[model samples]
Target: MRIQWIVSIVSNLVSMGLLVIVMGQYQVLNIQKQREEKLKTEVQRLANEYANDDLSKVTMEKLLADGNKTMTELEAAMAKLSPELEKKRKDVDACQAEKVRSFFQFPKIITLTRQCLFSIFYPIHTNMND
Candidate 1:
């Protein structure tokens, strides 16, 4: 009778251990599932935060307005300087034509003067040396 009772108690303790192990595994799985759900919720929350029309539209509008203002200012500056630029351009063209004429004429004058000097001085030099 003593051995039978001891055997029954030992079997009960083993069965209790198995039961605890099973419950612990189930708890772990439940915790993992809960964590996965929380992560999913957080991702959705962040997605909605950016996907909504909260700041994107306002920022784009502000940027476009600023760009338009800048473009208008740039156009105004160009318009104001348009006449001055035109005058400068005409002056540059006249100056360039004058430069071309002077360049071609100066070289011819220099060559002619050199030839005249050589023709006049060679005889003078030869007579003087003799």
Candidate 2:
């Protein structure tokens, strides 16, 4: 009974740890997705506008109304969306910055640590004096 209880407790703890790691990964991936969408939209908008000169005339009119006005509006839009974009950008950058952050960051580390710990218990003992 005691053994079973201890095993259950350890299993539950391990599962919880795994859950946290999974949630973090999901969050990071979601952020990447958001960043991807933002970049895609930006690219498509620019491409379409570039491809069709007059296609963006409506927006251009706003730009032509007053040069500074366009900048101000752009700035405002950027200011609002910039934070959200920046957040996702930061997530992606952090993920890219560290090999571990990309995907399975925590799991890989945990697995490596576990393996190392297990490996230390070899079939034969090494020279303790050495």
Which residue runs does candidate 1 get wrong by more than 4 Å?
Answer: 1-47, 50-52
Which lDDT tens digits does candidate 1 get at residues 13-101? 99999999999999999999999999999999999987776688888999999999999999999999999999999999999999999
Tell me the deviation in Å of residue 83 in model 2: 70
lDDT of each: 0.97, 0.86
lDDT of 2 at 103: 60
Per-residue lDDT, model 1, residue 69, is 100
